[model samples]
Target: MENVEESLELHDKYQFEVKFTYPLDKTVPYTEYNVETFMFIPNNLCVNHTTYTKDDFYSDMQKYIRLKTPTMLLKNILNDDKSPLKALKEAMKTLVSEPNNELKMLDYKYHLKMFCSIFKSALRDETIFAEKLNDKEDAEDYIKSIIDSTEDIVKKFRDLKDIIHVPGLENKCYALYLFADEFVSLSLDKYRYRMIFNLDKAEVKNKKKIRSELIDLLSAEIEYRKSARYNSCPDEKSDNEELIYRESTLKKLMGSVLFLKTQTMREGIYIEQIVMGLAAGLAMAFATAVAFLSQSKLENFTFSLFMIFVIAYIFKDRMKELTRIFFHRKIQKRLYDRKTNIYNSLNQKIGFCKERFAFFKEKDIPELIKKIRNKDYITELDNGYIGEDIIYSKRFIKILSKKCKNLLDDFNVDGINDIIRFNIRNFLGKMDNPTRPLFMPIEGDIKKIKGGRVYHLNMIIKYGMINKQDIYRKFRIILSRNGIKRIKEIPLTI
Candidate 1:
């Protein structure tokens, strides 16, 4: 009786049939049967649903997946009582309401995961998204919106500061202000995220532990800004005048202005001997002219007069030599007075400052300064005498100050050191070796020389050297005390 009941049930199950129809109109049919009935008849089951493919299932699944993912939704929303799955279903319906490629792809969970990963990565390393974000002019407006929002938070914090005694809030507030300041200062070429990151590192990281240090740095920067040291638009009035004067002055002083005395005086002594010889010739010529005129022969008188005239011409050249000597003395005196005035002025300034000029190496001019005093132009009793004067006189100082005050104002001890080095090289070049080139290698090239290869050459010529032309180039007499000491330390040489 149990076998009979099973057979009846099997027959009822085998009575139903199933079929599948593809989009191409091909159809497959099958009869449903129990395991026992399948022995008697060929049994096949065709399983088919709506026309949706695997891709369609994935597309539908993505919308629900994104809505369910923890990172995609806000923390507060994800924590609510509603089931994430149920919420996702509703979200998917809303999301797919619009038809687009993004909407079409939203159904796939992998697609959603990929999208979320890309978004997160972009937020983490904003350089990846910078181009996309900054492609529009409205990017600035978007950034301003974020800044405005942050400002509101700052305002709220400030408002609560009186009521709530937050110990570390002040530092935090300062850090925020620094961040805002840096953000506003950023250029369009710079990535906003980098600026923010730098600001956080520079300001926020040390704000709590090294509050005073951070504040001090900020304070100094603020003070510098207030002083207009880095002003983008400098005071145009000062700049314009400085520019005009620099152009005009440099143009005026373009070429060498020869002071004749130095050249003429050196050549004068030789010319004087020539003048005396010419004077003797003139006396001889006068005697001849008188002798010839007494003869009263017209041709001889004319010839003698011409000869006298030639001798007179030679004498006239000697007058030019004498005139030059007189003028050279006068010019030398004037130049000495000018140099003395400048030295006295500089000495006074240096004395008041109690800082000795590095080049001079003297507190005051010594009483036994015989070399300078021996000059015909300078008197031993002259109170204006400071010492052997520098080539940089009052006019040079004034002109340099006016033209390069901007540079000097920015100068430091290192710049002064460079100036000293430059002046030393210049002074050395001028002293008894003006034509012999000074060959100091550039700093980069200096390192290429082996240690043992380098050597020093120091020579002192007391009376200067005589050249092949028998011309005696005068010894440069204007050495500072330091210069004299430096020269004396070395043995004398030609």
Candidate 2:
């Protein structure tokens, strides 16, 4: 199952998280390698008229987008039947009982890493879900559940630490304890802010209570962090540096324990390079032939012969460039822009993700895409008057389902999360002011009114899987000179 959530991030950036879940139960027997996504930009806001180019778009994407290593979903980690935390606790018990067993010790470390990474992520997911709850009762329940779960987990960690007298592992145990404490504080802090900004006035009392509880949790976390065992600032750095140091240390620990690893490389780069080399050779052959023919005909060092040679050189250069461009375009048509390989913690390859980007004219767009765009329109006159430019992006993902399911013997692992954040700063350069003054007649006298000037950039994505019906989603991104104004989902009825 594939799910996507989209929202605006910062002021000029749009973020979307795509969750690819591989279910353990018998169902569709196909891979998700045929997904295609498209974005339609107004001509005035595109490279055709503005200064933004394909290179700029790609650069911005690289800066903003993030592809996190695939891990188990929060629900899966928190599942009562098969919890990583529970498994971790059991592993710890065994390690403490038989510390000399190297294989058992390694198993304990693996479980510890899996629990820490998944626990942190699951808390984040749960907190976000809690904040989005509309029912006050549900919100209260979720908040309480989070607090109870964290407190119980922390207590268990403390108990385990008390028993862990094994030398050379104090730092690891203390780090896990601190990680749980700090993450709860951070997640609750975020929840408190969400309640203040997102919840309604009717829940003022409940919100206040939640806020108070969150503050208490944060205070406890702070006190725990300041305890003697876990130093707040060992290096005696400034406050900001101390916070950075703690976060950096925690991240390093997490990296060490993470199960999945990823490596990205430019797709088809070698073959494309070879194709370009062949193109250059072809162009050079033509140029050499021209030079030979010119030399033979002239047979003298005269002005005419010099002119002929110069013309041949110019044509040769032009021919090489033209041929190179032609071959590049052909390569683009056949290959993706980038490829990412996914590997297990054991350094074995499991799956790969491939993505491509391109520009398309209206005439070149698919009929279904055009239909989705023109839905409910009174006429085609708008398109005729102001033709839009289309930007196409595609993803081909392939995962070994059995490998992911068997990642952890305790529970089935969830698939990858492709988090893409796109910045629209490039599209804002050519936009007019956010508001333009308009003169209007008011009671026989002319009055000025400030009218909003905005542009709409539509994006339509097609999600495809073998033997499964494709799903389509369209979004209208309202923009101004300042940045993105808002994004509205256009429902598909056809």
Candidate 3:
């Protein structure tokens, strides 16, 4: 199974996160996902093959895959009977109980790191959700729950720390403990400010109370981090160095547990070399045939023979180039632009992914997609006057599901996340000024206004998986010469 989520990352960048999941009971060890994005650019932008080439697109595009964030709810993680906290506590207890088991020790450390990552992710989601709540009571309730759960979790972690006396694991535990503490404090502080921004004047008392509570919590963590006997930083380091190094180290450790290693290469390199060789051979055969025919017709190095030789050389060069171009196009249709091999930390290859990009003619697009794009327009004449150029980008992903499951057997890791970010600054070069002067008559008086000029970049993303129906999403990106105004996702009924 596959899921795709799209959002605007920055003023000029668009992001898409594709998640691929494998069935637990299925015998097949692999799953494939195919995604195609067709971008329809306005004609006024003058975006075409000459203006925006494949190289230009590749330069502005970035793609990478990482293990999906484990799903652990903030409320459940701390207070539930069968929670991730309980699981990690049990894992660590087992490791401390059986100190001789190397595998258990490694497993315990893995769970600790994973718990830190899961808690941070869950915390971020909960805070964002709480901030977005429309009802004041609902937001207050949610924030209270977050505070309560975090307090419970912190108390439990403190108790759990006393259980870990093993010298080897103590340092790792302390580092992660500090990391989690800092993350919780920072997230709560940010939430406090954002929620305050959304509060009205009448809610000043409630806002002040909320801010005081969050600040108290964060201040306590800061003091604990500073005065703890097992300092996360070395005594020889200065305060600033210790702060920067500690943050960087903790982030690197988190990334080590979450991100996968990948190796990329140009796809079908050998086949392309072979195609070129064959084209050369065909050209050589033509040249030899011409030489033999000319010698048989005119014996000496005369004007006629020289002319034939010159013509043969010209035709031979043209034939070789034309043949190469034709066959390369054929090859591209069957192959991809690049292939990436995914690997785990142990250097075990998990799977491979492929990607391609091209510009498609109107006739080449699918009927369904074309109809969907034109559905909003009332008449066909609209397309004639305001037509769009189409750009197609494709991604094919295949992974050994069993391998991924085995690597993350202890946790509930469902899939891999393929994140793609594309910058659209290249399309802005030919754009007109952001605003134009417009004159209008208002109540029999002449008035002038600055009318905004913008372009519509309509995009349709088609996603498919094996043995499943395809999914489609449409988005319209409004852009001016300055930057992107906004991105709107259009609902799809067909």
Candidate 4:
């Protein structure tokens, strides 16, 4: 009883002496207190008190103690009765050496199923989107749904893999995981989204513009027709007539738009077809070559090899040329039709006058020029109008002079002319008779030519051998009369 009384007295005395320093007439700074002092403060006195109950504190204390204890020591203590730790260690070692093959097989099966399901889902989405593209909003919603579905499937696979454990299963899981990431990455690619968005925007803008222009034009025409009718002979006509006319005009315009769209689609299809055909042709050629090589005897190996290589080369070259010609022809046809359409439209709007005087005449020259006269600038040249006299006339000379002047202003023509002269001399030097000029004389020293340099027409004549003196003489006379006298001199030799 005395000892208990002594302890209580000691505790009271200690509590009385423990005085927290509160700044007088100023707020006490919480940070000044030591951790122990701060912790000792009562709930009411503490600045930011957390009300942790006794049970909560005890649980947290237990957890801290558990974490502080060494793992090995804890294991030993736990297995003191039956040595479960040793057994578990041995089991783990065995598991490492000889993993559960059955589990691995099951994982593989699950993985394959998931892969197939993903592919099926993707195909389904593509089909649905392709079939139901009547509305743009619906199409976008469908795409988003597809992406979401894909992401969900990937997550499912990930979750499935997480619960399973087997040797090499992780590797397979990792591969599948990477594949999922790739699929997601492709779907999320900003560039792909931008491309699709841009295409859709362009299509929308073009459609809007076309519709606006058509409506305005139609309205103007209707107003004009109404005015003309009222002025000429006022009569109450059936409203159906105007409606029918408008409908017909709209239909015609829509038909033209449809035609353009069809042409574009057809061109794309043709390109794809040509590419597939070329690929197939190449595959066939390779297969044939391999079969021929396999069947050939060792004695004729060199000859067969040579023949195969030569044939392959020839085939490849021919195919390249054919493709080039095909594309060139398509481009040419499109350009020709476009030009023709433009000309026809212009002619319709502005009545066709005499061919020579038509302002909107389809000439090779840029349409920027306001007026074109027959003797304007000593040139009346047209790409479509070809004749010997036109080719050799002052008009042609003036056109060439103007073009040459532009070229000279834009580039170092003197340097280019030098390069041309050097190449020509080098080419001529290779011949047997180097001193004797192989073609007609170029009218003057090419190096000394002023703004423009002249190339002899005969040098281009077949094999640099044919020299038509009459042509050269005529050319010279034309040039001299046109005040273009500085021509490169070359001997005429056939």
Worst 10-residue stretch by lDDT in candidate 4?
1-10
lDDT per prediction?
A: 0.27, 0.65, 0.73, 0.29
Q: After superposition, how far is residue 377 of candidate 2 from its true place, in Å?
A: 8.1
Models 1 onward score TM values of: 0.20, 0.73, 0.80, 0.19
Candidate 2 residue lDDT tens string, 1-494: 35433333333344333333332222333245456767777666645523656566667664212223335545455456667767877887787777778887778776766666666666667767776677878877777777777667656545665545466554665455556545434444445455445444435337777767767766666676667344442243455666667666765566465435788888998988898888889878987897788788888888987887788788888888888899888878999888888777667776777878777778888999888987335223434566777778787877665555445555444434454567777777777788989999999999999899887777787775555667687787787887777778888757
TM-score of 4: 0.19
As a whole number from 0 to 100, the lDDT of residue 366 in candidate 3 is 96
TM-score preference between candidates 1 and 4, better one = 1
Off by over 4 Å in 4: 1-132, 164-176, 187-195, 202-494
Worst 10 residues of 2 by lDDT: 21-30
The 10-residue segment with the lowest total lDDT in model 3:
17-26
RMSD of each: 44.2, 5.9, 5.4, 45.5
The Cα error of candidate 2 at residue 373, in Å, is 1.7
TM-score winner between candidates 1 and 3: 3
Best of the two (2, 3) by TM-score: 3
